[model samples]
Target: MYRAGGTVTGERDAQPGVSRVRRLGTHLPPVARAPGEARAFVADALRSWHVPEDKACDIVLAASELVTNAFEHGSGGIALRMRFTGDCLLLEVRDSDPGDPVLHRPGPRSVRGRGLALIQALSSAWGHRRGGDGKWVWAEFQLA
Candidate 1:
């Protein structure tokens, strides 16, 4: 993880395509305030990076949705990680739940079931990875 004001040039043994990387992260409490805190964290990081306002808004929204889902469906501590690759911004939320997120087609009148939909629509790419103890949901936005 890159420290504040530190730079990351990708890890050793990283793919040749990965040139630059910057990362920010925070551990979120398993409470109602997690989502809002996650959003604020993303906003601050993007602002420090000088990301454009429109793009930052989308990234912040994605972070919020991911964190909210983590708390709503997952277990244990929630952690938010944001990384700036050379060409994209990657956001990931990790939780103790081992199950993958479900994507549902909600009815028009439905008030929920749209967080993943919004992430899919706004992000350049999105996916999840499962580990022994938990899983991480992630999305990427183009930096350009």
Candidate 2:
């Protein structure tokens, strides 16, 4: 289960319902493998939840971006959690760094820095919060 501060402890599932599915994973920092790992993790969860193909694709991409951002700016290990609440799929990535991410406009010649932008454009809603030990970046996608 996840603590009030977004720290993931024991993993558990609630009663079978819209909120029946919950999954969490932790990865070491440097996050070189996080994006791909995140894609697989979210894809598997969404598939189990019977999410539609299109929405699942979007969630995977958004999850990659969130995880990538955490690795880039966050310190120590990172944690990822996914859950269903009503008709929305909520994905959260927590890192030990307390720095808040900033959305910036990249230059024309920029080869990167578009992660958050893609997330903002694709997800129904997204935000971040400072946790007890670090911060968690989250994005939500409509499942209906």
Candidate whose lDDT is highest: 1
**Cand. 2 TM to true fold:** 0.81
Please, what are the lDDT tens digits per residue for candidate 1 over residues 44-131? 7777677999999999899889989999887687888777865688898898888888877899999999999999999999999996
Tens digit per residue, CA lDDT, model 2, 1-144 = 112222333244655554444555555345578677777767876787788899889999998888888778876777888777648878888877788878878998999999989888888999899898899899888877
Highest TM-score model number = 1
TM-score of each prediction: 0.83, 0.81
Residue clash pairs of candidate 1: none
Off by over 4 Å in 2: 1-20, 23-29
**True-structure RMSD for candidate 2:** 5.1
